[model samples]
Target: MPTIASSNFPTPKSWDEFEDICLSVIKVKCKSTNFNRYGRAGQKQNGVDITGKDHFGFSIGVQCKNTLNLLTEKIIEDEIVKAESFAPRLSTLYIATTRPPDAPLQSFIQKI
Candidate 1:
């Protein structure tokens, strides 16, 4: 996880906080604040943590991975597969994490 540069305190205190940070990122990236957390903890969210439309009204989705280790290709692929069930379909699905990329995202899902 990314650390706070000023306070030295962890940027996110919990998994939910991590998701919130990712949600904010999605908002800024899409230039839209219309996104929201997808579902409650333990619910079947189809691998999406936060989802909504972008400024252009294209369906956008985000999956926050608060992994302790490097984010792996397999994990991303799994999430991409699960995201297929999301309603209205997604024009873009962003995987939010601090780790470096392990593999090409386009192989698992289109426009991700």
Candidate 2:
């Protein structure tokens, strides 16, 4: 995980903050896996959070949700489908969230 700058302590309170957290996570994971990290540009019409590319030149998409409730598998499935529609060549798709998803949702992510 990217170290939260000391000046940036305290949990995020908004969608943009949540998006920043997800982007940080993605950057760290990509770097650790030897993949290049690109930042999110804008929100998708269907609310996808970020879009970029990995080291292998494969397009990547990330959707972020910050909520207290556990995420549903349908949300993940829908985000993946939406991302595919936006970037058909995407090799990796992720629905990143602040709250850990429920068991079934986690399993769905694992399968993806």
Candidate 3:
């Protein structure tokens, strides 16, 4: 795979399309990625966009944010908190954003 900084992945046309890309990525990276029933935009999603079991059968939650603006600490933190309240619970929470996390945000996530 190409380095994330220089990845050739095409930009998604919309937020929903970005979520689909994230789901596809999760499927390729794992073996059991599943899109939530409420994954569609404008749905009453409880926070998670995708859910799946890891190789160890641990549930994982994915939230995708497709935006050109840089991510903020508050946004990332909020997503983490929301994922925590999702049903069935998740062993991990992932935020797939168009822009990579800044250093501070990355550190914060690593410390979680």
Candidate 4:
């Protein structure tokens, strides 16, 4: 099984390694759901760890944080902003972390 890692979270690793984990998770999730998906790593124009199109043809932007620690609201906000900047072109934005966010951060994400 693939896993995510980060300096701030669990075990720190290179960005490329984290990117790989993110891509793996997306692939597994999409495959399990029988969704046709396509992905790219660090595509310059995308400004995200991974970008993909689902079975329904909607574009998605994903940011992965490998840290074991809880994700912060600011980090989520920044990723959202980055996703929005790439918007209408991308239908949904997702921030995936190795560890879940704190209660406050989770609430913030729900509102975003």
Candidate 5:
């Protein structure tokens, strides 16, 4: 597989900035302008950083992970567990991360 051009874009300086970027991208891709940041800092967010209905009018949740290293299965699983409680019952959950495309990780996520 071709490698991702990580140098093509600037990494976010903080978690908040990362989430903001993810929010913007989701808005454009999903064609929905009603999304908002899910929760304040230091609060339980049910694993969602940004959320709202998508273009299909389905409830969507996004979790922005700003980790520099690879995302562990445990981390993903834990977040999914938390997200299970999000109200309105999210029709879809997106895990947006800075981590590169790892085949194993991708496989694991796909199985979910």
Candidate 6:
């Protein structure tokens, strides 16, 4: 993971804050990165929080969440579908959250 320098603490208080943090990390990790939100600060993000190209030129889409709760199967499924719709097409989809995925979620991610 890339190091993120922020004025705010690591624990983001809002979803937008979490997204910003994820963007920062992505910017450091990828060859190039873009925050995909438009309109107001809390507007719908159209599924992607950050998009970038890795060092190897693979496109990636990232969705950020600031929840302590486990990511439910339904939620992951929905996010996966959303990521598939991202423009320019992504070679990889990553969910950036403070809490790590549980065993089943980890397995699901690995399989995908």
* Candidate 1 residue pairs that clash: none
- Quote the lDDT for 10 in model 5: 70
- Quickly count the clashes in candidate 4: 4
Clash pairs, candidate 2, are: none
**Candidate number of the best TM-score:** 5
Residues 32-58, candidate 3, lDDT per residue (tens digit)?
645443456577556688888877788
TM-score of model 6 vs. true structure: 0.73
Candidate 5, pairs of clashing residues: none
The digit string of per-residue lDDT tens for model 4 on 5-91 reads 433444437656777667777767655333222345545444466777766767776777777675687777766776677744778
Model 2, 1-112: lDDT tens per residue?
6564433445569877888777777766665343322334562444356656666656676777777575677776776676667744667777776663378667767877
Give each model's whole-structure lDDT.
Answer: 0.80, 0.64, 0.75, 0.65, 0.90, 0.72
**Which is better, 1 or 4, measured by TM-score?**
1
Off by over 4 Å in 1: 1-11, 100-112
* Best candidate according to lDDT: 5
Better of 4 and 5 by TM-score: 5
- List the RMSD of every prediction in angstroms: 4.7, 5.5, 2.5, 5.9, 2.9, 4.7
Over 19-70, each residue of candidate 5 has an lDDT whose tens digit, in order, gives 9899999999899998999879999899899999988899999999998685
- Rank the models by lDDT, top first: 5, 1, 3, 6, 4, 2
Among all windows of ten consecutive residues in candidate 6, which has the lowest summed lDDT? 1-10
Considering summed lDDT, which 10 consecutive residues are worst modelled in model 4? 32-41
> Over 4 Å off in model 3, which ranges?
1-5, 33-37
User: Can you write out model 6's per-residue Cα lDDT over 1-112, one digit (the tens) per residue?
Assistant: 4453433345678877887778787877775654443335575655677776787788888877788786677788888887777777888877888775488777877776
Q: Which stretches of candidate 4 lie over 4 Å from their true place?
A: 1-12, 32-47
Answer with 1 or 2, whichever has the higher lDDT.
Answer: 1
lDDT of 1 by residue, 58-93 (tens): 999899877656566678888889998899799888
Instruction: Please give each candidate's TM-score.
Output: 0.78, 0.68, 0.81, 0.66, 0.91, 0.73
Instruction: Look at candidate 2 and tell me the lDDT of residue 37.
Output: 27
Q: For each candidate, how many residue pairs have backbone atoms clashing (under 3 Å)?
A: 0, 0, 0, 4, 0, 0
